[model samples]
Target: MNRQNKISPFLIIVACGLVLLYLHGCTRVRPLPGPAKPPTKAPAKKTEKPRPYKVMGKWYQPLPHARGFKQKGIASWYGKKFHGRKTSNGEIYNMYGVTAAHKTLPLGTYVRVRNLKNNKKIDVRINDRGPFVRGRIIDLSYGAAKKMGIVGAGTAPVEVTALGRPMAGKSAAATVPAYMPVDFYSGNFTIQVGAFSNPDNAEKLKRKLSRIYKNAHVVNDLHEKTAPFKVRVGACSTLDQAAKYETRLIQNGFPDAFIIAE
Candidate 1:
């Protein structure tokens, strides 16, 4: 073997070391990614406020909840004259649907209306606001009225019990009665002694009640030309106190007095 022809081991080892160092300098050693930071939490939504509306010269505030609500009053209905008209809740009036209109209950509320005359009962979803005539509690569709025996008489005494919004069924299926728990949480309660078409009359009643009550105020729409003024008294924090207050009011002189949510 010619010794000059063979490369020296030292040179070969040096060349290999240089090549490894060059490769190391050229190649990037990427670090393993660190644990991902926890995702940021999303902001929560805000609670919405209830909307109040006016009808037939009166301002009506919708109830926040329908728990433990009961009312006794006249119930009437409408048909062909308003068959395709849009209701207060923005639904097209269907006279044949098992729906009703109420002055203050929430638009999506479900109620059990009992005809006091014949004890006939029907469940109706409150999809509109109406029956603004004094002493009337609810206005039913022609179909609902007929089911509860209210169509022939034109009007009937009814005991309306609030059943709240449906829990297991869609509100669109109002024709098929759904029984769900009423979700009425007690809040501020007051006695509505009277509601008058005249502002002066409401003020007079308020003044009279202020003599014997702690808080007697007139809820009015003085800005509106046709809105009726309501005289409410006794700002009780609970429903029981309001019931007692209403009883006292009825006994004192206001026979038409009723309990109302504030």
Candidate 2:
């Protein structure tokens, strides 16, 4: 009719170009499915808290007041050279456990050790700190100094009397104390490397161990109101010259030195 009206406009322009290529393949833009992968965050769990620690230039400080803490002095033992190691609260040192070591008590605090020259009592637990030398005050754990006979007098004249917290799964020798009353005190000899509730940090570790220790003093414990200064370093008159300056202050780093007959 005009060629069938030009073939009806070329079949209506090929059905409007196949409906615009099927509406451009249903509005194709398919690049939006690549942003849904962000869910991975879980790693945070560490809580250990129990601070304050320094060994040779001394800084201690770990006492949440282990109730009724008593004391007398001089008692030492620590077999097999610190047996299976790792103590001072991280346990593991089982020199035949009954455990003990207290520069400022409170690791587990369970003392009773009364070998005041043979009244022999035993029940230890403290866990570790030391007899950093200076009138020694408890360290035993070669099986509590061989059950308080003081392992053949390596040192004894004990008395430490704090029996505060320890019951669950008992057996610090079941809190032994059938009888324990012996008290005597006589002191001389020093090497205590540090103790302080800040007397200028015990005179800044008694002026840095009095420049290589000759007598680095600082003693002042009018009965501690929290660590009462102390810091001593020498004055050995014997106890084998304070055990040869506590084995040269524990080979010069003072791994908790010893020999404090004062």
TM-score per candidate: 0.62, 0.25
RMSD of 2: 15.5
- Estimate candidate 1's alpha-carbon lDDT, on a 0 to 1 scale: 0.82
- Candidate 2 C-alpha error for residue 32, in Å: 6.0
For residue 11, model 1's alpha carbon misses the true position, in angstroms, by: 5.4
Each prediction's whole-model lDDT (CA): 0.82, 0.70
Model 2, CA-based lDDT = 0.70
Candidate number achieving the greatest lDDT relative to the actual structure: 1
**Model 1 vs. true fold: TM:** 0.62
Report the lDDT of model 1 for residue 168: 65
Per-residue alpha-carbon lDDT of candidate 2 for residues 73-150, written as tens digits (9 for 90 to 100): 788888898799898678789898787888755577666788877697867667788878878877788887887776
Q: Which ten residues in a row have the lowest lDDT in candidate 1?
A: 48-57
Q: What is candidate 1's lDDT per residue for 1-262, written digit by digit as tens?
A: 6657888899999999999999998896889999999999888886443545555545455666667889998999999999999998899999999899998788888889999999999888899888888888899999999999878889999999998776664654655655556545467777777878888988998888898998999887455456469889988776668779888988998877777665
lDDT of 2 at 144: 72
- Displacement of residue 149 (Cα, Å) in model 1 is 2.7
lDDT for residue 110 in candidate 2, whole number 0-100: 66
Please report the candidate that would top TM-score against the real structure.
1
